[model samples]
Target: MKIALFATCIVDAMYPEVAQATVTILRRLGHEIVFPSGQTCCGQMHINSGKFAQAEPVIAAHARAFSDTDWDVAVAPAASCVASLGHQQPMVARRMGNDALAAEAADIAGQTYELSQLLTDVLGITDAAADLGSYFPHRVTYHPSCHGMRLLRLGDRQSDLLRSVEGIDYVDLPLADACCGFGGTFSVKNPEVSSAMLADKIRTVHSTGAEVCTGGDASCLLHMGGGLSRFQRTGSFEGTPDVTAVHVRQTSSTDVGDDNVDHLTAVVGADDDDHLTPGEKGTSPAEPSRIQSGFRVGQSAVHLARILASTKEDPLRVQSEGATVSGGSLR
Candidate 1:
């Protein structure tokens, strides 16, 4: 089968190894891989930030890029970007009153698939170790991105693949469905809230006692990894007291009602100093448990594609920077 690789902006610019690992897996399966050079950002960021006018051209260009490429199907490693192709692209085109472009966008969306969707649904890959020679001998946990879970409805496809990996000790992440608080610009705009949510995710990841936290979205993994790295470096979470038990209501807008605000305040409790934010400095702190003892201090955040592409001979190694696949370093 001929497959076109849609290396999303993050993957292309930040983590090209993910794209390369994706290609490696496809080629290992005897499939032809084609990278459409005209492809660029799918405009997910623009659309997400309400820049519909800016997103229209990007969505159109994405459609044109894949349309110009000759392939049976297109696949992207990033679930959020892929979800935007179907969920937001056509809407943006229609919002611009471009019916023809909207049609093209829908057509492109139909042809595109997330990596796990393509591997499991299209290619019928039930066992990663058996089918793709995936071997990751480490304690790993997966965080399903919101776009992949809610928009794409990619249920258990990624986790099941990870579970099938040879020598993998797959542990279910507590509150696995919770957002990692990296909603692109959402994180930047609401830094405090985002940090709070990220702290919650980091605590749960630490609880898992896993050496690595793998996920389908590079953006979320990047957020979690950066938070974990900061925790390891600073040895304390200052300026994030709300992170102790503050559950940021996952809503579209900032108009959280009194009930929600009350709920948020109610959940805030005094815990160990490790869990408390800087604001709760005077709170009576409990003894630090194993989850806070810096056991997985240098825990790695890896993309699922890299894990899937790993093998016994050419295993993906976790480095200080990130994971290296096939001896090629990722920047």
Candidate 2:
């Protein structure tokens, strides 16, 4: 299959690794990956901010970019962007009385899929460890972004794939379906409300005791990561920034850090057999221990693909940037 990559603005500028990793996954599956050079933002920010007039050109550009390319499917790693493509783009075009653009936008939206949706539904990949050789020896909790959950109704597609990864201890995040409060301009225009929502999300993540928090949207991840960074500094709810922000870093296996001696040894580089429960060892089952969660978010397709790729070359580890936990940095 020939796949065209719709590298969203956040992933392109801030999180390029996620885009590259996406290519890695598709190539490993023996599929061709094409990047349409004319691509830009899907105009989600403009549409969300109630600027339909300004968004038409963006939506038209998106449709034109893909229409000019020859590909079987167009996929993006971010669900929010995918949601905008399907839910917002055509609506915006029609609102602006661009019937031709509306039809084109609708056609493009039909062919677009979120990374997880493509992998699971179209590619029929049921086991990440077995199919993709995914290995990450860290406890992980997943956050399903609002657009993916409520709008797209992705419904556990991301979490299910993560759960199937080899050597991974998957924990259930409390209120996993709640928004990270990164609704594009909503975060900017409603700082106090956004922070309160983020605080609730961060608290739930902290409860899971997992080292990594992942989701389908880079924007939400950026919001949550910044909140974690600021909360660690101020030590209280002091102020809020009514503006959008993002930080990105290139990460490899070595960035997981050496200071976490016990956790590093226990989870990282462990064999598949090491994950077996006591019941499987001919012993009485021990009571289940609750895992505390952290503030990691938005690994997207590349991050997920590299986890599998690491199993073949280097073992996967966490980085202190781009969705780092509390007391960690995102750059």
- Cα lDDT tens digits, model 2, 113-157, are 999999999999889888887788777777888888888899978
For model 2, what is the error of residue 158's alpha carbon versus the real structure, in angstroms, after optimal superposition?
A: 0.6
Residue range 209-249, candidate 1, lDDT tens digits? 68888999988988988877776677556666553433234
Worst 10 residues of 1 by lDDT: 260-269
Report the number of the highest-lDDT candidate: 1
lDDT of 2: 0.72
Q: How do all models score by TM-score?
A: 0.85, 0.77
The residue pairs found clashing in candidate 2 are 21-302, 134-308, 208-291, 208-292, 208-293, 209-292, 209-293, 210-292, 210-293, 213-296
> Where is model 2 more than 4 Å wrong at Cα?
234-236, 239-309, 319-331
Q: Give me candidate 1's TM-score against the actual structure.
A: 0.85
Best by TM-score: 1
lDDT agreement with native, every candidate: 0.82, 0.72
Query: Deviation in angstroms for 330 in model 1?
Result: 7.7
